[model samples]
Target: MLKKITLVVATTLLVTACGSNSETAGSGSADSGQSDKVYKLKLAATWGPTLTPFIDASQNMAKMAEEMSNGRLKIQVDPSNKHKSPLGILDLVKSGQYDMGHTATYYYKGKDLATIPFTAMPFGMTSTEQQGWMYYGGGLELMQKVFKPHNIVAFPGGNTGMQMGGWFKKEINTVDDFKGLKMRIPGFAGEVIAETGAVPTTIPGGELYTALDRGTIDALEWVGPSMDIKMGFHKIAPYYYTGWHEPGAELHYLVNDKAYDKLPADLQQILKTAMRVSADDMSVRTQHMNAEFLAQMKTEAPNVQIKTMPPAVLNELKAINDRLVGDMVNESPMMKEIIESQQAYQTKARNWGKLADYQYIKDNQ
Candidate 1:
């Protein structure tokens, strides 16, 4: 009887320990669901397959996310050519047809006036200052407010530093030169140009050269030297003017709200970090390419003449820009809020920039 009693006790202890071990294993499985589950996402971009820096931002972000997540997160990017919806990225992401999208915010101006300020403003902050406002000056929060209602989250994808005004077939010597001018411009800048008695139109990247070559547009403002060189605009329009409209043109990445919410906490953080790293890389890479290509312009396009718009013309354009923006602020409360925030931040940042960057450049030159 004693031996039988001891055997029963030992058997009970073994069963109890086995139960405890089973519970621990269940807890580990729960954690593994959050940490190790594989997520595959699709991204639709507004750019063509081979457009560098623009396409590079999306590609790099995908690559970084996969590596950072150790293959648990995979993003596949589809270019405009394959998707056949270059301008429909926002809609695609919003409907969850695409998990993400890469495009410019200004493209959605017709959808929401509040979206316009996020891209670039005429006579606005430089790229560096704009980025500072974005990361530090409550810009990101404001951006979320604008996007949340659409079931999308937006982040800065990349920036093309101060864009050139446009390539004009004829030189703009005075404000009168804008009269009846047909120019390819976009966003608020298009409105400002229209105020100058110019007909402003938005053309896709693929059709710009054909449109310009065939006299469909008298002038067109693409990007700076790096992008424009490949477009062969210099061969057609000899006059290359300086920038004003898009001082800091920033492209955006849009995330589907539902898709993002479904991600584990660690994956969410990883995705955000990847976006930031890739975006910064694109900004610096763009500057490097622009510098390198600008040097080659003299040899490639001998007829290309770099011209600055006249002071009188610039002053007139600025006045129009201010009036139009003021009108927008009055029209929409959201626009007013965003513009006020940006203006306040720009004022604080501009003062320091003048003392530091502007003065340094003036002194150096």
Candidate 2:
């Protein structure tokens, strides 16, 4: 795992297992390049290099693809620092400017509202439930259905289990406290918060710390302690809130339709399998990092207060979230199918999980 996978623009391009006589897997190349052929891929990421769970997921995917394909597939990951367009990864990949991209479906809600649910929905499925819904419960089909028109095939790249609500400069006790509050939040969660009269600002990952430090933003939600620790938000914000908005925020691995079509059968499967492994690895890694970083926070940043939002405020947000989804569903036929599918799958999955994992955790806590 220590071996480097690949690099990008102003980044190193590593072909780890390339034979000395390897050929290019280019479309017009003579050698049909099966054995020693190297397919060079460029992947743009929405996360900055310092963002762990996201960056780690991208690297792991590249490594898996390289190792599995014996260097036939080499992906160079370019973070926002390199690309300077974290929020625009979807466009980068869709335009074929990049072969692939690591981003969340929710970021492009303005372009396509249907992209929202594939990432996370406020008060929707938990991580486990969402994973089940995605693979075994017809979730991937719906996701593909939404992305097909965009000319990019989206895959589940990574998952951050139950995300922390955010770091707040002040505790939110009542519903009125949300009004006019500026926060760095993304996805549909931003829209959900905006419903409470709060202004939701989508800041790039690298800019969040400066934004919070300079009082440019009142609060922000940047994953859990794992990723946020590097941002040092705890130094400025004392109140760390529990999650409600993003129960299971999922990252997306987007592949350009034309690019993916060029891959041979074996390499295509290898790429898909690599993505699957990366997705699962991120979930486990996130859980581990969250636990370790949280402990680190308690010891180093002792002043940070971990608090849950008051039920009154949570109820208001939940109400708004439900109304928003309900309205979206009624408005878009595709949204209705996707939501109905998710609900039907998640409800049953949650019930089954509740009796075992849920009860065990609940009783112990």
Alpha-carbon RMSD, candidate 1: 13.3
Across residues 236-321, which tens digit of lDDT does each residue of candidate 2 receive?
99999999988998899999888887787567666776776678778888999899999898889999999999988899898998
Q: For candidate 1, lDDT tens digit of each residue in 42-142?
A: 99999999888799899988987897688988999999998888888889999999999999889888888788888999999889889988877777878
Model 1 lDDT, full chain set:
0.85
Clashes of 1: 0
- Candidate 1, run of 10 with poorest lDDT: 21-30
* lDDT for predicted candidate 2 compared with the true structure: 0.84
Give candidate 1's error at residue 59 in angstroms: 0.3
Using all chains and alpha carbons, the TM-scores for the candidates as numbered come to 0.90, 0.90
User: Best lDDT goes to which candidate?
Assistant: 1
Pairs in clash, predicted candidate 2: 7-12
